[model samples]
Target: MSVSLNGVGLTHANGQVALSGIDLQVSSGERVAIIGPSGAGKTSLLRLLASNLRPTAGQVSLLEQQPWQLSARQRQHLRARIGLIHQAPPLPPRQRVVTAVLAGKLGQWSLVKSLLNLLHPVDMSGAAAALARLDLADKLFERCDQLSGGQLQRVGIARVLYQAPELILADEPVSAMDPVLAGHTLSVLNEEASRRGMTLLASLHAVDLALTHFPRVIGVREGRIVFDQPPATISPAQLDALYANEQLQVLPAPESTTQASVQIPRC
Candidate 1:
């Protein structure tokens, strides 16, 4: 198995409970999509699974090892085997895209090699190939500040592809993309995960995209999991209940034909 969470929960130092009583298990090569309304603890759950945030309750076992129980150095080594894709990648404004992509291997590279690569990106071809998969090959030499939000997101994904970790955790990865581009980009991501047999878990606001791309879907609300089932078995009512806060904005409609236009939240 790739990961197991036994009654996992997280509470901030300020006494804010981000998640509680969550239980999830995923095996190697499984691709699961997490769907939820904003502030529903999706980000917290992914972060917790990635070992970026420790749980306040329950146990988390990832890549067959308990992260909290491991020594700091051991934990650092464990992190090298995982790839995290942020919704908004924090690339330095002055950094080149090639440098940013090559930085993905810094955890595995020797210190001297890392320093040399920083000076003049050693794996330009490798970085270019990763970018090409996302239709950003031409931007290899571009500066981070010169790209738009969607382009930056692709760059972030390119970095992960270059990293080729055992597990992939993405949080709202395609939020900035146009509908067509979003669909295409997700296809690219899913294809890569399948090809490499990487365990993939992503949290997405686009429910249709979640259903179309992932075989398994988990819905979360109020810091708790509402449902975890195969996409074909998930009913419209369950999805409705998961996003049932009348006070909040309703989720958007399916943006493109690539996404199945069925059973979505509405005002």
Candidate 2:
């Protein structure tokens, strides 16, 4: 299993419950999409799987190992085998794109090599190749600040592709792009995962995109799994129920004014 969550629950330090009873499992090379309304614990769940947060209750197993049970050093080693694509990839504004992409392998490289690469990108071709896959090869030498939002998001994905981890987790990976670009980016990501035989789990807000791209979709609401099934099995009624918003208000149309007709005196 690439990921397994058994009765998982998380409570923040400020005493806020983010998730509870999240029982999910993904086998190797499986592509799964997690969809839910905003603030519905989607990011929290991804964080848990990434080993960024420890579950207050229950277990989280990633890459066949229980992350919380491992030692700090062991967990760090484990992290090298996993790639996480953040929505706003925390790349340094002034940093060159090549350096950012090469940083993906910092965990696996020697300290000396890492330091040298930082001073001068030692693998420019490798970085360019990865970016090329995402159609950003021309931006290889550009400063991260020069790129647009969607371009930056693609750069983040390229970094992860360079990392080539066993498992990939993305949180709103294509949220910044146009519909066509978003679809293309997702196809690239899915293809990469398939080629590498790596497991992929992404949290998306686009229900139609999720249903179209992923074979299996997991719907989350209010910190719980509402449904987990193939796209074909997910009903529109279920989606309506899942996204029902009680706080939504419908505004009435503006009242029309009836103008009085004036009689023409010269007729």
Candidate 3:
């Protein structure tokens, strides 16, 4: 399936245009990274694809279904086929990690079964397996509220991993973690998405991370997609254009000028 956004624009309640005249496409099994400075509308783009927000103009389609045209039931069905990892892991605070992971299966399970799980809590074996994959097995029975930022994000990923959606949309999924954990999490996500042949589109702030993991990269600036190209082929000049003042500060400044200019590999 393909996620296509054509001339899509989104506006905020305060009359700010979050995204405008954007045209992008993600084919099945393509791992794309959207990279840009802060306030570049990365989250906005993700919301559009996830159908959490309707486009102010133009069209957004996933698997050939127009999001707004679908009935409530049909929308839910379509949403079930798409997995999203928010920048902040939004799990129920008091819910156990296993329960949070099991929430992923609610779409596939019957309503009665969903309600029953809410009460008795079942199917933890799969959650345990996913936790093991992320080296979070020890935290399975722990409450989501008690976990650290990184742990909460892992719990979120575990849920999506179990859901096995055809499309995965991640917005700064590793922003809260240290370099080591961030790399580990992203590697696991990218590997699993590849193994399952699912399309993965992730928004990222780390330039090298996106360059290292994703073959294709899209650069957003001021709510517009400024550049879309292969990571390896993207020039520093193009990066400078996208980030401008922001890029000079973040990118390797030149070996002679300052000690911080050196490139440090991060997770």
- In terms of TM-score, the best-performing candidate is 1
How far in Å is the alpha carbon of 41 misplaced in model 3? 0.9
- Pairs of residues clashing in candidate 3: 179-267, 183-267
- Compared with the true structure, all predictions reach lDDT values of 0.90, 0.87, 0.85
Candidate 1 displacement at residue 245 in angstroms: 1.7
* Tens-digit lDDT string for candidate 2 (1-267): 999999999999999999999899899999999987778899999989889999999988999999888999999999999999999999999999999999999999999999999889989999999999999999999999999999999999999999999999999999899879998999999999999998999999776668778888898999999999987667656666677763322222112211222111110
Worst 10 residues of 2 by lDDT: 258-267
Which consecutive 10 residues in model 1 have the weakest lDDT in total?
Answer: 252-261
Q: Sort the candidates on TM-score, descending order.
A: 1, 3, 2
Residue 228, model 1, lDDT = 91
Q: What shift in Å separates residue 69 of candidate 2 from its native position after superposition? A: 1.4
Query: Cα deviation in Å at residue 34, candidate 1?
Result: 0.5
Cα lDDT of candidate 2 equals 0.87
lDDT tens digits, residue span 1-267, model 1: 999999988999999999999989999999999998889999999999889999999999999999999999999999999999999998999999999999999999999999999889899999999999999999999999999999999999999999999999999999999879998999999999999999999999888889878888999998999899877777656776887763333343344322333555431
Q: Which scores greater on TM-score, model 1 or model 3? A: 1
Poorest 10 consecutive residues by lDDT, candidate 3: 256-265
Q: List runs of model 3 lying over 4 Å from the truth.
A: 247-267
**Cα misplacement distance, residue 11 of candidate 2 (Å):** 1.4
- Cα-lDDT of candidate 3: 0.85
Model 3: per-residue Cα lDDT over 127-225, one tens digit each: 899888899999988998899888888888999998999999999898888878888888999999999998999998877678778878899999999
